[model samples]
Target: MKDLKEQKTEPVQMARSDLLLSLVKASVSGDKNAVRTAVEGIIADEKGKQHRVLAERLTRALHTNGNGTRAMNQMAHDTGIRGREFLAELTPRHQLSDMVLADQTRKTVDQLIEEQQRASLLRSHGLDPRHRIMLVGPPGNGKTSLAEAIAEALAVPFFVIRYEALIGSYLGETANRLKRVFDYVRTTPCVVFFDEFDAVGKERGDTHETGEIKRVVSSLLMHVDELPSYAVIIAASNHAELLDRAVWRRFQLRLPLPAPTEKELAVFFDRHIQNFDGKPGIAPATLAKRLGPISYAEAEEFILDVRRREVLSMLETPLKTIFADQIKAWEDRAKPMGQEESAR
Candidate 1:
């Protein structure tokens, strides 16, 4: 019996080792199909060892079926982008009315949504709906939100490119990863968003930049040019000045979302506070005056902080007290650079 068990385990051990080797190779080479095959092989090996429950558990976690990424998205099974970690695919829920925007920006978004809705009609007229979009703004000023809103308005899948995973240091690696992203999105009608786009789209003319960046930019622009209007590409940059000159021309719409003025902040404040169970005791205009110009993200954070204090206090503290206490802390945190600590 001991001899029989050892002989039986010998083949299983050998198969396990081979499968693990394949897994390592597939992972290092970034081969998704090979990884799947290796994992399935391992699962079979586990089953051969009479570890049926463990094998079934491992098989369940492997997400071998087409429904792993997006259960309802038929495109997941149809494309090679399945299981890609660098692309976060989502069904956007934000509407245009969810956030405040400048009048012109809002109108342009509305127009784009309308154009996309009537895209077939436009195609019949031998025209493609405008799809390439560039959003320029400071951090936390609704650039990302606006992209999501557009995708939501169009009722399309929203794909956010994860730069951390997409940017590889190896020669030609980054461009290749970017190409895969564009190819994947092109297979289906979806909204692809590249946030912090200046990271890849930086000016090729910059004295400090390397040839690698220039080549990457060239590759990116080529992909953008070839992308069909059916797949919308939205890229947001904090430093529009840093983007390649060619990148600007590639985008059909380059929208600027600057920091909100005091008045605009007040309007945003009024709209934002309406959702709260209790309104802020301080008026929007007065709060804006005291807060100075800040990103909508900061404004929202301040509001939430005040609400947190209010909630923790069990509504014992007045809204006025909460606002007065939090505003000083908010100012200290948000003060302009080069301002002295004492002055702050």
Candidate 2:
């Protein structure tokens, strides 16, 4: 007994001028590519609404623009080379101020930031900014954070290279995907971070490695060389010794982030713990001394654990008691580096 009107599909939510604002922005930007992309998006949207006549008209209009049809045809052919296939866009949340660095590291990072901010001035005098960086460090340090912060500092798009999506089972697949990655980033300025870079950039001369590894390394370095100055590549590797000899030459700056000292860890912990509403009962330095050697990541994680436990306690446990118990528990679980190696 339903009415005939009820049998109809729900109205297209965006049928009434929702895409017009995008069209306006694209038109004002004077970027033909952006305008074309916006128009095509509208066409697709309209087609989904069963507005076949209107969609056909929009398509005809788009085709009239110089090279639009040809460009779209090319796009259709290379539809597999999508940014999402090998890249993940990240929100640039961290800034240089958000991290604590050694004196030398801070100075170098500051210089790079200055150079990038004044890239136009440098280019006018026949200079290119230093954009190729190799971050060598132990795991659990601030390598990834540093890359993200640099992108934030420069107000650029931050993209992390997804090895999971990029690596293929077929021969020559990985290199092709890497090339596609470089091809997409070249069109615009961005921070392209290759974390755990040694996975593909291993030493070519290492006979223990496969021929495919050699090929991937070669392709990776080639793309690195070809990328424009505007496209910053920040490659981080824990096993720096495993990277190719040629790979070492490709980077403009090779920075190291070593394991933190007790004082340094304490300082880092203090900065983080102050952010929590339930402050630590003991001083960060005292707590850090109790925890022994640890990475910046571990310090942050410890703070999180303390905060979580404190919040869940619902005011039953004193913050000081909770803080002391956490320190003891964490220390008990963490083995000495030598003991871990021996056990292995």
Candidate 3:
């Protein structure tokens, strides 16, 4: 046994906090060689403990981040959307309220990091990691907002693939236009966000569908398969089933975003209700009961719309009365069926 003076740090036994501290030290130093050396040291010392796995993970992370940077740089040169402008472009159109994150989209940003690490691993290993992800759910949910959040989380370029720019009427032209996008992904190590994926990657089975879509799909698949691990391709479609199976397969991970629950709605309203001057006649619990099947996006819009109506009201009225009609309509729509159904 080793003497008290020569203590052994168990790699496998290391706490998550310790492992993360090791990683932070590695990342902050900005030296891959140093990170690699530190990881190696940890692995060597804690060969039988929890630290070994943590070291291995940290090594992979550093490698992926480095490779992702290279791929993003190449992509920038290819697409001409790099540097400060690219960062600015990636910023969200609307800022996310901290309350909203807590209320509705908990752990979303964390999930994106996991996704990015997966993407980076694929790249480091010379495999095409489908970073192209789409969030599909009802409108007024935080799909687009989540996209921005992902960009911020990864600290990479985020570009909104303008649908109009890619959709063209000319024959064979649309596919060619899409090539520019794939080229951008190849050049930039960033997230290419397609807000409404269905609009672009529509079903190719229809008779009215031109061969152009088929070609576009083919091009997209080819590029998707060829994407280096560092690039992320995220597409959000309300109708995911409509996407081609091949397209679906290309994405390494598919997260199904669902509507907010009553608890979530209560949290959502609790945060935003403060904006109103007077008491909101409807309680949060009541609002939550009414916001059934409401997506994160809808919840936000509803709050904003309510505020707008109250502020713009012509007559001086109690806050509750000012928004009485809308509240009633919501309540009527949300009336309980008062029945229990078994599993379908």
Off by over 4 Å in 2: 1-81, 335-344
**Lowest-lDDT window of 10 residues in candidate 3?**
79-88
Pick out the ten consecutive residues of candidate 1 with the lowest summed lDDT: 70-79
TM-score, predicted candidate 1 vs. hidden true structure: 0.72
Candidate 1 lDDT over residue span 193-242, tens digit each: 99999999999999899888999999999989877676899999988889
What tens digits encode model 3's per-residue C-alpha lDDT throughout 133-206? 65767666677777777776666667787676667789887676676666545533567787787776767786
TM-score of the candidate numbered 2?
A: 0.75
Tell me model 3's lDDT, rounded to 2 decimals.
Answer: 0.62
Query: How many residue pairs in model 1 have overlapping backbones?
Result: 0
Which residue segments of model 3 deviate by more than 4 Å? 1-90, 93-109, 114-130, 203-208, 274-278, 291-293, 309-326, 329-344
- For model 1, the superposed segments whose C-alpha errors exceed 4 Å read 1-83, 90-93, 332-344
Please give the lDDT score at residue 45 for candidate 3: 32
Rank the models by TM-score, top first.
2, 1, 3
Candidate with the greatest TM-score versus the true structure: 2
Per-residue alpha-carbon lDDT of candidate 2 for residues 201-314, written as tens digits (9 for 90 to 100): 999999999888889999998889877676789999999999999999999899998988888888888887777666568888898899988898888788889888888999
